[model samples]
Target: MADIVEVRNKQVIFKDYINGYATGSDMVVTSDATIRLELPKNDDSLILTKNIYLSCDPYMRNRMNRTMEGNYIDSFTPGSPIVGYGVSRVLESSHPKFKKGDLIWGLVGWEEYSLIKDTRTFIKIQVTDVPLSCYTGILGMTGLTAYVGFHEICSPKKGETVFVSSASGAVGQIVGQLAKLFGCYVVGSAGSKAKVDLLKNKFGFDDAFNYKEEQDLNAALKRYFPNGIDMYFDNVGGKMLDEVLRNMRVHGRIAACGMISQYNLDKPQGNYNLLMLIMKRIRMEGFLVFDYYHSYPKFLEMILPLIHEGKITYVEDIVIGLENAPAALIGLFNGTNVGKQVVAITNE
Candidate 1:
C-alpha cells in the first residue's frame, strides 16, 4: 500500500471549446480526490510529479477554440483539466531518463499531481541559481522565443532602428533588452503608462508609448522611428502589425511571435497594409518556440550570464494556490497580468 495525503487539489477545467474572446467563466475550478505517492499496480510506465508552478501564456487562448484549424497542436479536451507548460518536481518515476527528486519544466496537467506517460517532454533543470519559476518564463519558452525569433529570424544589425509591440510582456521585455545589448535603437509600445515606463526605465528601450493612449498607432511608430523601422518584433497583430508594415524600411525584418490582440476573435483581423511588405521588400516570418528547442543550450549559455550580471531582469506575476489558477489563466486574454503570469502551487 502507498501512503496517501488528502491533497486539496484545485484545477482549472475547460468548460467547452471557446469562441471569440476567452473569459474567466470559460474555465471552472474543481477539486479531486487525494492521490498517493506511488503508482498503481502494473503501472510502470508513468511518472508521478507534483506541479510547482504553472505558466499562463497568450498561445493558450488558441487552444481554447474548437474550430480553429491548424492542428499543429491538439486542442484541450473539454471537461478535462487544462494543461500548459509548468515546473514540477518528480515524486515517483517509472522512466529511466527522470529520477525521483528531479526538478523539471515542461507540459504538465493543470492539477496538483500529474501522471505523465511521455516523460521525454520534460527538461531537467541543470541550473539552480535562478528562481525555479523562471523555467516558466525567461529561462523557458518565453526567453527562447524572444532570443530565437530576434536573432535567428530578424538577423538584427547594430545601430538599426527596432520596434516591438506588447513590449513590456514577458517575451517583449526580453526582446527589447536584447536589441539594446546589440546596440540597436529600440522603441516599444505597450498597453498602459506603467508598462511604457517599464519599457523605458527597466528594459532600456530608447522610447516607449502607451498604445492605448495613442490615437493612431501608425503616427506613433513614425514619430518614434523617424527613419523607419529596420526590425519589428511583432507580438500584437491586427492594427498594430498593419501600421508597422506600412512603416517598415526597405529590407526590414519582422518576426511574428504572437498575435494576442487577435487571439480571441471569431475571425482574426486581417492586415490592410500587407502591400507595404512587397513595396519595401520586407521579410516577415512566424515561428513556434518548440521548433527552436535544439538551440536552447546555446541560448542558456548566452542569457544565463546576462541574468547573473544583472544585464537582464525578469518580472513575474505570481498567483498563489491552485484554486486561483482559473482566474490567473483568464487574466492573460484581458491583459490583466502585468508580467509573466504564473500560479505558484507550492513553496518548494
Candidate 2:
C-alpha cells in the first residue's frame, strides 16, 4: 500500500455574495486547507480523489449570488471552497464502483484534494486515449449540455436554418457542428471577431457574425437568415433573445441553454418582443444537463467516433495551475477564452 501522506490542499474560496459582474477578487486562492491521504474506512461510499482538472463555466456565475432560485444549485457559501465539475483520479476508495487509480468526472471542490462522499453523480473514465482534460468540457458535462440542448430540446430538422448565440463557446461550438452534421443551415453569433471566424472556418458554421460589431442585432439576423431562422440555440439571453424572437419563423424551436449575458446583472434584462412567441407560435424551452445525464452513454456513443474520425473538433483554453483558477473563471464573463476554459490542477 502507498504510505499515508499529509499535505496542504490549495483551494479557491468564495469571498462573498456578488452583486453585478464577478471579478477574480470574488474568489480567493489559498493553501490553508489540508487533508490526510488515507481514505476513511467508516463509510463504504467514501472516495478520496486528487483533482486533475477543473471546469470554468458561465453557469457558475449564478451560484456567486445569494439570491438565486432554489433547487437548481446552491449559492457558494462565503469563506468556503467554490465547487464545480472536475476530473479526478481516485487516490483511495471504499466504494464498490470505484477503486484506486480509477478516473472519474463529476462535481467536486475547487481544491487539490477532496473527500467525496457521494459517487452517484460521477461517471468513470471509460476511454483514456482521448484527452483526459476533455472530461471537463467535450467529454463531460459541457458536451452533454450541447448534445441535450440541440438534439433533445431543439429537435432540429435537415436543411433547416439554425442560429446559435455564443456559438464559439464549449457548448455552442458543439451545437453548431452537430446542427451542420444533421444537414441544417447553421449560423452563429459570437462576442469577438476571432470567435466569429472560428465559427465560420473551424466549426463549419455556414455563417457567423461578431455580435459586438453589429449595430443592429435584428438586422444582422435577417441578413444571415433571409428566409427566417427555423431553430435557435440560445446561449445568451436578454437582448439577443429578444432580437432572435423577432426573426424566428413560425413553429421555430428554441433551446434555452444558458443566459451568460444575464448571469452577472443586478437586474435581469427583459424582452419586449416576447409576444413574438405567440405571434410566431415558437416553442422556447429551458433545459438542465443534470436532468439528461442518463443519455451520457448515448452522447459518447455518437461523439467519440466523430472526435476520432475527425468529423468533430473541440477547443479548450487551459490555465496551467489551480492558483490561476480565479482569473480563468472570471475570464468566461469577459470573453477572454476563445473556447472551453479548463484549469489544470495537476500536471498528471
Best by lDDT: 2
Q: All candidates' lDDT scores?
A: 0.88, 0.93
Mind giving the per-residue lDDT tens digits that candidate 1 earns over 219-303? 9888998889999999999999999998999999999999899988888778899889889999999999989899999999999
Model 2 residue runs over 4 Å out of place are none
TM-score of each model, paired residue for residue: 0.97, 0.98
Tens-digit lDDT string for candidate 2 (1-348): 567778999999999998999999989999888899987767899999999999999999988988677639888999999999999999989999999999999999999999998788898999999989999999999999999999999988889999999999999999999999999999999999899889989999999999999999999999999999999999989999999999999999999998999888888888899899999999999999999889999999999999999999899999888889999999999999999999999775
* Error of model 2, residue 246, in angstroms: 0.4
Candidate 1: where is the Cα deviation over 4 Å?
2-8, 41-45
Residue 46 lDDT (model 2): 92
Error of 2 at 137 (Å): 1.0
